[model samples]
Target: MTYTAMKTLSVDYRLERWTGTAWVTFKMSSNNATNTNLLNATSDWTVMPGYYYRVTSIHTAYDGSTTETSKHVSGTVLF
Candidate 1:
């Protein structure tokens, strides 16, 4: 969602899916400074049912410190 830095940090956001064989990053953000925005219905991203996904953020501080965090969402289709 958001990365807070003491000063300025390089941040990247990615949307990944578990495709049974591997974890794939379908969408990614360019290098950003400060914070990241959320992907919503208007974001032009398609949501497929019966898949596991995660929203991950990787942040690197000006001091060369780095940390990563991720949030997961699960969905299933009713056939």
Candidate 2:
């Protein structure tokens, strides 16, 4: 997924089981007058049976000079 913003920026993601573990992949890039940014990530998430999973806003921001912020979340599913 790709996001482009002149003001506020946001992203949404979902990782579902394929074979063994669900692999979540994401990337973000921007070219603005103020700065240029690049980011990438990959993870294998496992979900058990008879359970639910929910993950909220994972955010990342990078300026040409530095990585500003990054966040992640993981939740269990309940049947």
Candidate 3:
């Protein structure tokens, strides 16, 4: 018997700021990996005070025949 497998993983990050009425995306980043279980990414931004900011992350993984996706949003923070 023989088996073959192919795996792919990707993550996308977005930085949002509350613009008094709605949340707007200001910065974005993407990372991808193959046949790996761990992925790491980083981003930096200069934020002004007196505003609320948040981060949204989208993660996706695929293994030969199946694909899964999840999304997460962080709590707002004042800067």
lDDT of each: 0.53, 0.41, 0.83
| Alpha-carbon shift of residue 76 in model 1 (angstroms) | 12
lDDT of residue 66 for candidate 2:
38
Candidate with the greatest lDDT versus the true structure: 3
Please give, for residues 1-79, the per-residue lDDT of candidate 3 as tens digits: 0133338878899999999999999789998878777677788888888989999999888887888899999999999
Q: Which residue pairs show collisions in model 3?
A: none
Q: For candidate 1, lDDT tens digit of each residue in 1-79?
A: 3343333445566677778898788787645454333322213467677787766665544524645444434352321
- After superposition, candidate 2 runs with Cα above 4 Å error: 1-36, 62-79
Q: Rank the candidates by TM-score, best first.
A: 3, 1, 2
lDDT of candidate model 1 versus the reference: 0.53
Ranking by lDDT: 3, 1, 2
Clashing pairs in 1: none
Candidate 2, residues 1-79: lDDT per residue as tens digits?
2243223233344543223365333323232222223334444555566545555445544433433444565664453
Root mean square deviation (Cα) for candidate 1: 6.0
Candidate 2 — what's its lDDT? 0.41
Error of 2 at 64 (Å): 6.9
Please give the clash total of every predicted structure, in order: 0, 2, 0
